[model samples]
Target: MLLLVAAVGILAVVGFVTFLKLSPQSTPISSQPSTSTKEVNALSLYHWWTSPGESAAINSLFGVFKNSYPDVAIIPAPVSGGAGFQIFPLIQSLVNAGEAPDAFQMHAGYEARPYYDAGLLEPIDALWQSEKLESVIPKVIRDMTQFDNHYYSIPVNVHRVNVVWYNQKLLKQNGIDASRLTTWDSFFAACDKLKAAGVKYPIQMGPTWTASHIFEQILASQGVSFYENFINGKILSAQDPTLNQALTTFKKFLSHVNPDNSTTVKDWDDAIRRIIKAEGAFSIMGDWANGEFKLIGMKHNTDYGTIPVPGTNDMYGLCIDTFQHPKAASHPTNSDRWLKVVASKAGQDAFNPIKGSIPARTDADVSLYDDYQKGAISDFNKSTYMYPSIVHGSGMPSSFKLKLNDIVDNFVQTQDINKAAVAIVNQIQSTLPEFTKVWSLE
Candidate 1:
């Protein structure tokens, strides 16, 4: 009987061990939310790259990621609206609500500084170093991602801002040679000729960010370093001669624009249409504007041609769309891994072509691009003068951007050149202190 009882006990012990091995174990339930350490099979990305072309460009990176991490799935949650105005506010709300995405697009500028300062961003400095991103990317572009010796973002492209897109048919009809108009004086001369040739609006401009972009281009072409220092608060005097010169030049340029521009135009699309129909002779805009031109099947350099803003000597202002990893405990490992792929060489090759910007990587082969894009790439390669876009850089706060917009709107209406210039200077003086204080906190 004792032997039989011991046999039964042994069988029961063995059975229990077998059951333990075969049965699914319950995961430890903690009062704290579960953190995911499992290999990340999915990720959510928030961005404003909703345009078909932009989406196509972004998908290239997605394709590469899938190849590298076959198990990972990238869910792109695109938010539609103007980049600075609509999308950023939405991101701010999400961060406040503790529902930020795994990663999101950010412009490499003082604008991104706020998010970094808020402790919402995960620095990818180590990943950048490990990937040897410096070897691929230009120093100017790489520097834009770094703040205080650490990288906070991955640069995807370099936008040439000070470009003038002109209507070729109109120029040919007017017997005007674009090549001859290389200097500011010659550019203004062409504008005058276009105006005299019964061109309704020799130059088209709207009341949106494009206006400020044009202003920045003019300022940079004149003396980028001076404006850079002015924006950074290193130059506080409003009456600085360099600034006065820029303002004076801007006033002259404004004179050549459509007189009824305030009532006539609404946005970039409007300006593009006017230029396309030869209603306007030229539009001063960034290289990204080429996408709109191409969308309409306009033959580049034949239907239209691109040139640097007059007076600039092979200078290109950088406007980069970067992705920043948001701090998330549940997906930290995956987020870090995904960021490495973003800054990788494959990412640049896939992303820039469709996005209508040159790769931020200096080593990128741009042979696949069209003539206009190739022109931009060539200029970028040969560029010695590199500056940040005033629209993006200028460590000024969002509130300041709004204030400047108001100032610009008023200036545009009044057409009082001196008063307008003074207002701009005064606004800078008032806003510079706030930006300085915020930047100093770093």
Candidate 2:
């Protein structure tokens, strides 16, 4: 029953790191390209942004950097995977071999933990002070970028996770008021109506990770404090009534999703497309799906609309993209220059519009953003609280995050609430020691 979602997480670590480096075609790039040497001459960048929207979004930033550094060649080295699954492992290999790129893309919070712990990254607190970013960027975001009281990365964009994307026409045709469907009880009641009206699957879902992604949102709906304890490894019992309640809720939610036997989605976007085709009424996805809607010439609030995932109206589930300079970067000065460009208001403005996320900078140029983004920006500015997303690798450790997708997948196929609940607790208990950072979201 568990569905409604978010993605871009693949903290899919270690096991695949070796294989990716061994395969030449899979290896994204070397630190020094044998093309440019000086710090200002060229820069090798490693990131996982190979998709159409993501590529163009990054290109916009490239354009900004090019305008300023007219002589320096910007060598892009993007890995082809969602959320740096292949790229992070490759970085591990590159750093070990003394071939780390000048800079690389990383998620804001816990994703940087392993790198910082291993002495693989360099802190840039001085840059923050020089640019006076402390006064502009939100404190919570700044806190996420720091380790032991120092800044290490610059957040470029913020993707809200607690988003419900619905086809406006589909809901209207079904006589379901999405605004009224703001609680699980009402959501399921609407699902019942859709099913009775021959809408077999009222909710669309995708691969395993989407289910895990949905599970995180469901858990967060309990409360920010509950989610904080969860990420900090506190929920460790199937007997905990609230934990089981969340599991039960997920099961109920999955019931509304398209059954795997008759139909299956290729990925998150495929599920989103189902809503566009009127094959489904809802999809819980990140705002990036808005980019897809915009690309197809769909209008916000007319063709599609978004609400915070039920019960999250006052909160923002933050999944941020940040950039950092590595310790042994091939071009340190060029890497420094790249970080400067990424931190600039111009870089965030150009990248976030295409990226379908709001700019990380507080004073964003509103005119450049679309209706959906403008709403998100407003929600972000005044949200009750913001929590890092586990599905997107900002909340939990890699070990637990990787196992979560399988756990959610198994639970969906089996619909075994007790088993899933037990599995979730057991995994947390085992991985508790790995969850070092004490997140104070609430």
Candidate 3:
């Protein structure tokens, strides 16, 4: 059975390589060549975008694609979870069994390396060249989309991960000056005051990913140089003094989170909802939470307000939404067709406005974006300290990420700074064997 598995794997690699060499161009949007409402049958797409706001944004893209490829059936398999943690392993299983979806969502960085290296992905260099992506996509993000010199995915939107949103009413009612709290010291002081004013949970929180999400923002908040150093593997362990401080501070911050957390409200949207309703003072989440507010017709700055995670004003923590093609896709042509639309300016314009994320395309219709998005776009252009999010699949591999999530979740539950710091180093050491070649942990 082991031999059979190895043989199958080898064959898959050979087949994919040959296909890469033979395929001259990706299935362009013009492939259908007709505007008839003929069904080309179903194509399964797996993603984790079941939230109200997420669905609206994704459906916007569907509306565009359906107009062109009216015959091709597009089946959506949306799982409910932030960061697709529940769906990542499931995708691996489908790939292993040669039953992969036509196309699936992926983070366009080291996270895609394992699948690409395993011959489970279809290269889209043809599509990139035909679409002239180099001229439009930012060089930094475009570079991350490639593996082994081939582009394999299309980035749709970019979400800022290091944002703190608060109910404006709550802030005013509690005599809090949101603008003055630009550092952790000031932020925590405000949290203290909010607490004294009988604000039970000043900061709304969700489950493991939410905790890990805030931790990364806090880690980056220390210093962009330090955050970049850690992500680049220049800082070897969590035992490092700066990282220790961040971890200890993380433990301190947890006390402000609502005690009726995770068990009652396990979704980030729920946490955001609490903030919007004036029941909670704040929520540290990605800009997608802004989309949730927009979905309910809530106005920004009035209903809710946003600030960079304290001390991260000059930094932009990015969480890019990208999609990848599977080598064993039952509908490869349809998959590429779908991706073509995702990479187009029109699709990005339609999608990002409803998604509360900025378009990945540089030429997107910025006029169509809201105030929050306009602010994010301006920051994306100006921020000197832009970095991909560690918690959101841009900074680490699956195994290491899973390990980090486990440690952080445990730490959130226990509030043990020393143990958490030690566990981080230990886990990284164990994970190094699988990642040393890819990571620069010198």
Candidate 4:
């Protein structure tokens, strides 16, 4: 609680700080849109995907959207930092000022709750029915789009959150049997073997957000029922054994990670680079990191490979990315057009393959996707249990998640399991009122 209060205080004193986002194909800092501005033949799209692979993927979708509607220009304003961390507050300010973009990147599920609760977003139920999405998109994904009995967002791609990416060559050289590492205990034993063989940092991680991400993976590996309660705001007590146990496991995970902080690793991609260079053995990042590996010409199952964050093997951890319609959109028609392309089979096929995610629509052409994505599609189909990701903003309130970043970061430094568990429970209690959306992920 003190952590958030102190953060709010700093923001109040310094005023709003906007990060510098420079791009040849981006909106300049001087020309940020205003609510009362007249609608042009342009669609202002706000997102936070500025990385090499991420940028290419979004641009591919832009090309698809353009082929159909070349008249409607796309103004890409990508605010890049900490994944979505730096963009969230800026978007909040814009939305509060009624300057919301025509359409912006929104993670499906509770991440879109505040907008829908405040009635700032327009539901797209008509599109769902017209496009026959009900039959094409999976039920779990469809449910993620709906809140208060209306669909508010259109998911473009789905990322598996519980993936543990590692250098396959390193494990083979170390004589560790990768196939047998099916549970956390066995996984840690492999790490132990690597450590004994002079691999100082068996795991590589970057920044606080990455730490929170791996922590969520550990929590999800606790099983679907416990994780479902976690996202639904049901983990209310600090004494909850499962919660505590997860924190303990996360502590062990941090011990194996690189000693360098952000200055050294910088971001999640850097950690994957460490694995590629054989400086580290593993990285617990989403499949987005696969895009980076591919960008560098690394082949799957040869140079690197992934397994479900140990103990989460048949489970598909959800990190769905969607676009929403704002009630005060400047170019309403363009927004609708963008949503259509986002939901289209062609657009998804172009975007997700380069983006390292599976199309939300189950009927996508699998041949366009690589082996990792093909396998992900198979896993998405077989998994009856889908867990929402906390670090990625698909689960819990924004308040809870903001506070959680600090708690987990502190735990990484202190390795204090009990303290992290208590702090997390307290933050959950304080943010209970904000958790109005009830998730039915069983």
Candidate 1 has what TM-score?
0.81
Candidate 4 minimal-lDDT segment of 10 residues: 1-10
Predicted candidate 4 versus true structure: per-residue lDDT over 1-442, tens digit per residue: 0011111122121232322222344433212346676445667777878778898899999999999998765666676665476655666666676566678888887777766766678989998888888898988889889887899999999999889898989999999877788888898899999999999999999988898888888888898888888877789889999998898888777778888955687788788888989998989888888788888888999888888888888788889999988876756878888999999999999999999999999899999999899999899888877788888887888778878889888987898877888898888878888877676667
Off by over 4 Å in 1: 1-33, 36-41, 50-52, 66-74, 80-83, 234-238, 258-266, 329-334, 394-399, 433-442
Please state every model's RMSD to the true fold in angstroms.
12.4, 7.1, 8.6, 6.8
lDDT by residue for model 3 (123-194), tens:
889999999988899977887788767898999999999999998888998888888889999999999999
TM-score of each: 0.81, 0.88, 0.88, 0.89
The Cα local distance difference test for each model comes to 0.68, 0.81, 0.79, 0.81
What is candidate 2's TM-score against the reference? 0.88
- Model 4 has an lDDT value of 0.81
lDDT of 1 by residue, 1-442 (tens): 0011111122222311111111133232121234563433455566766545566677878887888877654546665543355556656665666655667778886778777677777778788888888888876667667777788888777777788889999999999998787777888888888888788568888655767778777777666566556556565555667767776777777787776555677556567678888888888877777777776678888898877888776677778888877765224555676777777767777777666688777777677677887878878777877676757543355556666666666666665656756776677777664563322111
Name model 2 segments beyond 4 Å from true: 1-40, 260-264
lDDT of 3: 0.79
lDDT of 4 at 78: 74
In candidate 4, which residue ranges exceed 4 Å CA deviation? 1-39, 96-98, 440-442
